[model samples]
Target chain A: MNLKAIWWKLFCVLLLIYVAIAGLLSPVPRLNILNETIRNLYFHVPMWFGQIIIFTVSLVYSILYLLDTNQKNASSIANSKRDIAAHSAVTIGMLYGTLGLLTGMIWGNFTWGTPWSSDPKLNCTAIGMLIYLAYFVLRSSFTDIDKRARFAAIYNVFCYVMFVVLIFVIPRMREFSIHPGNGGNPGFATYDLDSAMRLVFYPAVIGWSLLAVWIWTILVKYREIKLFWNMRMNNPLSAVALDQV
Target chain B: MQAIITLIKKEATIEWRNRSVLGSLLLYTVLTVFLIFFSFRNLDPLSWATLFWIVMIFSSVDAIAKSFMQESQERWFYYYTLFTPGQLILAKLAYNLVLMVLVSTFTLLLFSLFVGFPIHDIGFFALALLGGVVCLTVLFTFMSVIAAKAGKNTALVTILSLPIAIPLLAVIINFTKKTLVVQNAVIYSTDIVLLCSINLLMIIMGYILFQFTWKE
Candidate 1:
């Protein structure tokens, strides 16, 4: 690997180490009863944070793709960059979404007295996850590359808006939840989270984000290779076509 | 203005020509309303109103998806209408709004006849219905466009529409509760304003984004 790749790997390693040490050893003294259970927050919240970051990256790439398509002198480099960014975002977003659901389920089991509830927040999140899952389903259903990408990009934009409404707006509007500041249930403020918790939480967010980016980079490279193979398969006479051009 | 009028007229004409589609939508709406009224026979006025909103929203989805999905099957006509995606969206929104209003009113009327609940404030109820219809139409119009290109149009439309529809659902239910249970006009006035804001936002966003979505 190149120097930049090596540096990223080192950065990720250090982040993982920091999260491991901080999450285990840190004394969240403010959370008197919950104790070690509060540590799950470090992992759970970061997964959502990382998912939002990846989704934002995906949206940026989609806007770029739309603009690039309209341009007469679009650079291959720009197209490649947009492709890499988009593929990376989707891959990372999927991972974060899966991890978030898993961690949230565990957290829910302990805090809410059940693994799942009909709370609006939980329902909306389940719906959001299913929507993204449908996004991949829509992508796989199409055999045409150009059509798949275009359709997926449009769907991504639509889902992102829904994500905003469901995750952010809807939960805040209704007062029916065990989550923080929703209904009668006590939340983070009730816990009086210690400074020590903050120490782990911030780093966990950073670590998860870095790991997502690292995984995204690898996935983008893999996608590029797959696309390359597909193109070569489709255009057996590409060499002749290139010679004529 | 003329373009918009023509587009609206064209959409109405197209919809009229497809009598089966319109027939199915109307039949579905009527059946849903009847089922809800039958199932919730013992429900209080508040619960009845809640069920009514649910039926209306789902039925609106059935009607609006038809209009949006027709664009994909008639690609040439859709492209020809591209001289005005905003006007086309508005026209679609207007048509769907009218359809939703008719369906909601008919369902509510049948609900009153069957369930025998007194509507305390007819004026507030009318305002709530207007707000709810506008919200549903604007929201579903955008959803219809998104679902138009989806692999399974029916499933995708439902998935994509539900999340956005929740806010509208929440507002409508709250308004229904206020009107039917508490008989409070003041509570629903705020909700009606919020619903109107949502309608305005959906329209502006739809106007801006429909171009991106509608491009061939």
Candidate 2:
């Protein structure tokens, strides 16, 4: 790949390496309770940021797929491409969300004295994850590629709207949350002590988000290549046109 | 408007002709409430509220699971020619709302008779129940359409809708619990606002998206 095409990928790698080194060895506030564990902010919180970015990408592609289908000049191949892109983004978003949950559990174990609690944030996250899991189940039940892609895109849009509502409503309804900045607890932002943490924290979020998008693009390309190869194996002549795509 | 009303009436006539489905659902509610009654002769308000919502969720799922699959393909084609997808979905949603309202009323009556009636604020209870019913019916109606298209049974419908319904369920359950167990706790308008907005969102989404699912 040329430098222009791979510049963001290079940026993601370099930034992540810096984060890994500085996140651990960099000077942090010496607090009474969260002396060392505060470094989790660098790793754990960025997963959610990355997940949200990828999930938004998935939602946009799903919407595009629907809008494209409604057009009179819609092509089958382009429609399928949008569907594949949306699915790949969701699959990667799920990975980021799972990592966030795992990292959160470990942090909660040390600080909250339990891996899981009745905290609204925790429950809402779990429910959001389940919604996407059901999306996969819904997709797998279909055998026809066109039907699966169309219905999955429709379901994707539906669930994303509901999930956004859930995230918006749940935290406001409850008066208490063990998570920071909700209810009465101090937010992680306050613990920055100085501008030192924000320097690492903001880059960590951006780097992880870019890394997620990069993986999603790779997955989309892989699927397209596989589709092309299968087409070539079936009919040698038809394969020439798909090469342009 | 007229088409939606006619479609709703058609649905009611079909449901009326097949009374066994409604009967079985009522029986299921009774059996569930009785099982809970026998297991715990006396219960506190918290358990009462918890078990009540549990029954509400399951029974609603059972009742609305058949909304789309009960019709034949030929009948759907016939209806498709006569009415637009928006009209068809609106009618189904309205009919399911009525059916769920009846089922929930019966369930609530059974709970009051079997377990002690813990809810003192009838107005608040009714408001919460209405929100819950609207949320469940709109959501399940759309989901049953998807499940039927997949050519699967009620299990697929349950798996698909239940997870997405959790947040609405959580809000309703929390509101009901407040009405039942807490004293001097005012009814929170924000909760009602949240429920109303969620219901509106789902109904609008279902109306717009049903056309995509209805396509053959």
Candidate 3:
């Protein structure tokens, strides 16, 4: 196999092993300290952290796209770069968001007495996900390629802003929260997250983020290949130009 | 000044001309108020206040989501406007805020009449209504831009809007309870401050972000 394929396989194996070890072994004697429920933090906190990192990357690309559109560049190079960034961010953001929701649901099932409740934090996350889902639907509604990209970038930026307000600001203001730390629940403020918890939590976040970037790179390559094929099929002469790159 | 007023007037006129939009908004508002009254025919004042704000929140979503959809349908005209996005948003917010206040007033009046609850602090109730209307208008304006771009109808808008609206809804309900039932200001000072802060934050954030999403 090619060197690139070998590297990707190795990376996947390493990631799987790391996640398993961290998830299964790290919460050991601490289980006696905080109970079996503390185990959920291994998955839940990292998913939320990964989501924020991906969304921050998405916003940067969106701002870059707006700036690029106003500047002069080789049309193909500019479009390709912007498309890669935009598509990668969306894919990774969706993954992080999905995992975050799942992990939170799992954590909730044990901690909050039900898998899901209308807690303010939980509700805000649901809304944030819907906003992003609408971003995808908005892209699909437009037939023209350029219009779709432009509109999607604009909507993506809006979603990011709304995400900040809904998730960060709104929940803190309310007096009725089932989530820890707000509204009368004795939260993280009281219980010190031990050094042991931090060890696994930090690495889990880094590992998940790196995994996101690794997957994003593969997806970008796939997109480039697909675009190249489309260009070739549409005009055989253009195929030579792409192949040279 | 004149140009802004003209834009506001033009938007208001267009909104009025869309008879179906206004008609539905009015009908929905009236129906929701009546439903709340019917559902809690014998509930206490606190329950009545809670049900009233819940209905208002949903009604606000219904009316505001359509605010931009009508303009989006005629893309060419919307894009050809001389005003910047900030101006357009301002106009939309002003128009919607007026409509929302009127709707809230009508709903509350009908609610008071049918439910036969004693309103303890008239001034606090008015303040609560004003705060609720401001919060709803700013939040809905932002959501309208999102819904306009999303192009999914009512369900999508609700999913997008309901969460953002919660803090405001909570404050409104709490304020109403304090005003219409408890008749105490000292109990809800913090809630009032939080509601005002949310309104301020939403307006500033919505203004800053409007141009990004308003692009044609």
Candidate 4:
């Protein structure tokens, strides 16, 4: 990795370590129905925040892909690099979304009496996840790499628009949603989250998002490495090493 | 504007030429409604509304997929020279929207023939039906284009359309179900506006994005 990436990795690691120790050891407001599980706010909510930012990054890359005119030439600046950046952001963003959902389900089971509720918030997020899953399916059906990038980027833009509708717009319109502020009586039953929780909560969001960006860059680099592997696939010297790895 | 009209006329002539495809689609709709009718012989109002949406969803998928997939790539190559991607997509959207509206209306009639229409405000229900049809048409048309470009993979039609459809469907379903459960009640106009805005957003995106996919 380069100097900037090294700095990012250093910051991500340091921040996450701080979040874990300080977050776990921090004093939390004791309340019924979520006495100790309240700490999950630091863990579960950050995944969602990280997911939204990562997807927004993916959306930016997709727009860049669309704005590019050099898409015709494979080796050009608009070709594989931007395409891979868009793809990497999408895949890692999907991973973060899935993690967010799974964590929410566990937290719900503990606090809400069931792992799955018909809550609009949960349902909409599920829909959002499906939108991205469809993204991957759209990607797999293409055989030409360049066309794959173009079509998938178009679909990515469309998916992000719909995802915003489902995740953010729709939930706020209804009053019955279980999510805080929009539904269920404003911000976790009107008892404001304690100041200490906000301290870890804000940093966890930053730390987790940095980790996502770090992973996203790794995937971007791996795309180039994989391209190299594909180029060298027929070489006898590389065959044994590839097989062993 | 001229390009879109001529392309649409071309699409119409092609659609009319393929009578068997239309016949099979009607058959598929009838069979699906009949199956739902047999399974739930007497459905409650909510169930009836849900069933109607389900039947219409499948038929719209079939109808729109046929519009995109029926054209062989050789034909697409011809059209590529003849019209721009924006014109081609807009024409296809227009044709499929008209086709789905007809199909959904017929499905509603056939579906109610078996299950019965428990909807109180037929006017708003029809409005919701039209809005739902627009959503389905715009979405499946966009998705079918993506699927068609990916080498005419038909299975990708449903896989790609559902996630996008489900959220929009939730709004429509809730709106439709409200009419079913409470007679002559007004659903929040905000929802209707949101739905319309979704349709508007989709067409705008289609207009902007089809150019990139149009590249050879």
Candidate 5:
């Protein structure tokens, strides 16, 4: 790993430490129903932000894989880089999305009287997970390696369109979305998460997203090395791959 | 242009020749809606609206899943050179849209016959039906091509489609809920806009991605 990436990982760790301590202990606005649970704003929302950013990175890689399928003097690393980035980003992104959903459910149970409230945002995230799960199912169904990646990339792009609609359009269109934002009412921007909360919330989002990217980079590097090692394994007497490790 | 027209014509002729398939699908739709009515007995307007949509969603999925299945291997190879991927998908989409419109309208009729009409806004209700069914057909057709190309497994087809399709289902159900407000002919601008936007997004995605899919 590069020194720069290590520094980023260190920064993410430090920032998350600050978020965990401050997020729980900080003085939050004591609104009637929400009361203490407003602290979840710093933790839960960042998971979603991180998930979306990671998924976007995954989608970018998939697009690159598709566009570069027919191009020039592509090194072996560059060729497989697309699959590595897309696969790892999706793995980490789904992790964040699942964690976000669980935390949101817990927070909802405290504030909204029920964990499984029919909030449009909650439903969208749930469906988003299902869509990605289907993407995995699509991947496993294919026996050919290159073919699987091609189809997965295509599905990834198409499904993201639906994902965009779920989060952005549907919640805004509905009139009772329960998300404090956009259900015929002004969204999270105009209300909810007062300035006091934004202090932790913004940093929490950045830290979590940076952590996700760091994990993703590690995954990519590991895969790249594995590819290099496999190439070296063509000659059994070679210890060259071990030197890189 | 001619390619698209010819493909649509071919799709229609084949569908006509295979009348029993369409007949059986219609029979299945009738039975499904009827069984639902018998089980529920009588639903409130909202419940009825939701039930009607549930039936249409499943039936549309079943119907559109067949869009890419009818071609023989040799026919597919022959047509591969005859049409661009865009032209092929456009024709399939157009044909499926027509099929969904007819089937959905028939479904609405059967729903009224069996389940009783709960709709207050006939105008908005039809708009929702048209928009919703078109959305269903577009999505499942796009997914159908992908599923068809992947492995042609029926169960896998539903698994392939359910995630992306459910969000559209949720939006349509919510839109239908608006229509059941006990008011006369109420259609909100916002709901209409949202439904249209979802449909537009699906159509554009289908157009863009089908080329990659059909290349397989």
Candidate 6:
């Protein structure tokens, strides 16, 4: 493997290992209620940062897919890959998002005394999950590859815009939520960071986001190979000729 | 502009020709509201706002989902040669807006008639309704096109539109709830601006994105 190509992967691995060890053992502010669970900031918060990073990457790929379609000399293979990238990114992003939700729920149970509350951020995450689930369903309903790719890209773009608006709009509607950084409560940045947590928090965010992209690359490659295998199976002669080559 | 108007006129004439379709939509609204009236008998202002928006969302989906589906492919092919996709979508959006206005007004009247209108500031409520209708119409109209293109899976329309419509519906519901009483009336200008900006964004997005969907 190329040293240059694998630097970030190595960084991601090192940072995450450091986080796992240092997160549990590190001293945190002995605040009431939060107490030891304040350490969740290292894990739970990074899931959202990772999810948003990957989702933004996915949205960009979707836009590129749409834009590439307009050019007369555009390569269909590249366009298809863009669609696949967008799809895979969404899959991984959703995985991170679900993890974020579950982690938040577990933390909320211990802290807020319930598995879930009607917090704006929580509701937004739930709705955001639904929108992406619909994207997958919409993709599945179409039979033609090109048509499915195009339509899914369109929905991906539209859904991203709305998801972002929901993220901003919902919290503003209700002035108070139990979540940090919203309504009266000071965000983690102000009250909780305290330099030591920031050491782990920033690295954890970067590490998790890099890990998401790494997983996304693996997913894209798997899907691409699956597509290639399907194409070959449909044409045994092509498979035989390619095997000879 | 003239082309858009003509296309909207064409939509109106088609809806007028199938009068039963419009009547059935109204009947759907009335029956749903009647069901709620029977079940609840009395609703608090919050529930009233919520239920009203729920009915509006579903009925709007039912009404607008067919906007693209009702037209035959041959007619679309013909229009494809005549008008741009942007013109066609804008026209459909305008027509759906008008249709939703009628449906929402009818639903509001039925709610008042059955459960007693609780809205104190009627004029402000109208503004919120218009805002909700415009956003819902814009988003659903585009989603319907995507649904129609993807083999006209009409159920896909609701699944696709409802989640995206959450923000708009949330703001409108909150805004309308405030209008239910004269004393708690704090009509935040930010919400109104949010709705307007969202409407503008949806319109621009629909116009741009429909071209890709229209191409194939």
Measured over the true interface residues after superposition, the C-alpha RMSD of each candidate is 3.1, 1.4, 3.7, 1.9, 1.7, 1.3
The all-Cα superposition gives candidate 2 an RMSD in Å to the true structure of 2.3
Q: Residues B1-216, candidate 5, lDDT per residue (tens digit)?
A: 999999999989988998898898899999999899889887788788778888887888778888897666687889787988888889998999999999998998998898888777677777888889888888888878767767776666788778877767777887788776545443467778888888898888889877666554
Cα DockQ of the candidate 3 complex: 0.28
Q: Could you give the TM-score of chain B for each candidate, in order? A: 0.89, 0.95, 0.90, 0.94, 0.94, 0.95
DockQ of each: 0.39, 0.67, 0.28, 0.64, 0.55, 0.73
lDDT of 6 at A63: 96
Give the lDDT of residue A35 in candidate 4: 82
lDDT accuracy of residue A206 in candidate 6: 92
Model 2, chain B only, scores a TM-score of 0.95
lDDT, model 6, position B59: 91
Provide the TM-score for each candidate, comma-separated.
Answer: 0.87, 0.94, 0.80, 0.91, 0.86, 0.94
Q: Please give the distance, in angstroms, between residue A94's alpha carbon in candidate 4 and its true position after superposition.
A: 2.2
| Model 1: residue B26 alpha-carbon error in angstroms | 2.1
List ranges where model 4 is wrong by over 4 Å.
A1-5, A69-78, A171-174, A186-194, A232-245, B181-188
Which whole-number lDDT from 0 to 100 does residue B169 have in model 1? Answer: 81
Candidate 2: count the clashes.
0
For residue B92, model 1's alpha carbon misses the true position, in angstroms, by 1.8
Best by DockQ: 6
Q: Write the per-residue lDDT of candidate 2 for residues B69-116, one digit (tens) a residue.
A: 888889888987899898889888989999999998999899889987
Reference-based TM-score, model 5: 0.86
Give the B-chain TM-score of model 1.
0.89
Best model number under TM-score = 2
Where does model 6 exceed 4 Å of error? Answer: A1-4, A73-75, A170-174, A189-194, A236-245, B183-188
Of the two candidates 1 and 3, the one with more favorable lDDT, higher being better, is 1
- RMSD of candidate 6 to the truth, in angstroms, is 2.6
Candidate 2: residue B59 lDDT (0-100): 91
Candidate 2 per-residue C-alpha lDDT over A88-197 given as tens digits, one digit per residue, 9 for 90 to 100: 99999999999999999999988888999988888778888888898899889998877888888888999998888777766443568878888889987787778799
Model 4 C-alpha lDDT per residue in residues B34-106, reported as the tens digit of each score: 8988887888887777778888888888889877787787887898889878788888999888888789878
* Model 3: per-residue Cα lDDT at residue B69: 70
Q: Residue B23 of model 6: what lDDT?
A: 93
Q: Ten residues in a row with the worst lDDT in model 2 chain B?
A: B181-190
